[model samples]
Target: MSLKIAVCIKPVPDPDYYDQITIDPVRKTITRAGIPTIINPVDKNALEAALQIKEQVGGTVTVITMAPPNGEESLREMLAMGADEACLLTDRAFGGADTLATSYTLAQGLKKLGNFDLVFTGTESADGATSQVPSQLAEWLGMAHLWNVSEIKLKEDQAEDKVQELQAKMKIENGYIEYEVKLPAVLAVSRDLNTPRFTSIMGVMKAKKKPLTVFTVNDVDVDRTLIGLDGSPTKAGAVFTPSLSRKGERLTGDLDEVVEQLLQKLRAAGINLEIKSSSQGGR
Candidate 1:
């Protein structure tokens, strides 16, 4: 049997030189107008990881997402990138979903998709950056979770005869840590993991003929009440940009004078200054 893998991907506004994003307050949505859209960077990396696994282990890659019907464009792009199948979970009920609700919708989709050896997701989304959905999906599905994976290697367990083992090298603050995990796991890939390949012309042609599946909340056998806004636990309260003020003074003088001036300014501002004298200071 071949390894079966699924990758969860998202579409994001393209990052231009200016790195600007526009959001619609009234709709509680992002306005992608005049903004180029592409695969979410981390999600692309996750797809790249899945492609690598499929190439080595001989399997199929399925890409899935939860968004508006128009979001199928993102799935088409994934198909162009060599995914064997694609699925979109879209419905009005799924609208205005926070991370928790979003994960619930995705979990419902995954359940309908049936047996899989692994699930991959990006560490975070470019727009939200909440980093909550993947872990929440893992929790909902009761699957083992690994996050921020920088590198991954799979070792087939011929001895066990029914399982595969994955060795993942993850980057931490201090150094890299390795994890030996069994298959049928969920992994949230980081941007540092690997480079995603561009869609080939042939692949694009092939994608047009490939099968793309669409599922609504009903098809997934999920409670309609458990999906969408009413099903969500968290709500978007408000959003506003903070105002920033800039005021500073530049001082030039001898070392001692500069120190004295800095201390005086701190005192004037009612800022506490802790001063200690060491024998080597002047020398």
Candidate 2:
């Protein structure tokens, strides 16, 4: 049986150029006007998992991203990583989306792609680091979902007519939990799952021939009110650059005097405190 797999990828500002990234105070969104982007780190892990599965199960891997036209380079990189096809959902309306709105848009894009036996995503995006999209997207699709996956195993029955199942180890705070799930599931893969394969010259050459479709809100069916900043419930109250300058004051005296001086400084800094007097100065 041939499987259809979709990997959700994100284009993040390259770490090398992080100094160029800024926040748009008016919109409360990331300003990437000039900053270059690359495939998000953990997202490559998810794509690698999808590619490995496609190699083993005789399937096609489709990589999808919701970003601006500038993200085309990131998609091309994924194609070079062996994805058969790529899709980019880009629209001015998608700006300033919170996790909920973002996931809703991505879910609509996935719906446009038809059916998929499995979906892969990074455990969290580098910029947002919310770790919410995976479960939200699974909810939107009404599919079983798992996150922080450490390992994946495929099992097929011995009978001529067989069913394939997947068992995976999921990382937890204390250790790991094992789960066996049926097909058509979603996974938020951990970076520890696998090391992504490097793109070779041959892969790059082949990637040029692959299809990369770009879509807007007009192409995919989506609720305009539920896909951007306007629909998002959580809003940024204040966005500003923090001052990095520091001031230091030296305290000199015995331990008790130093402790008393520090407490005075804290109180002066607006920290409310109530003290009970110690008789005879005994602490």
Q: Which ten residues in a row have the lowest lDDT in candidate 1?
A: 14-23
Q: Estimated TM-score per prediction?
A: 0.82, 0.80
Clashing pairs in 1: 93-228
lDDT of 2 by residue, 205-246 (tens): 999999999999899999899988986878977666667777
Report the Cα lDDT for residue 116, model 2: 82
Tell me the spans in candidate 1 whose CA falls farther than 4 Å from its real position: 17-19, 22-32, 160-163, 245-283
Q: Which 10 consecutive positions of candidate 2 have the poorest summed lDDT?
A: 155-164
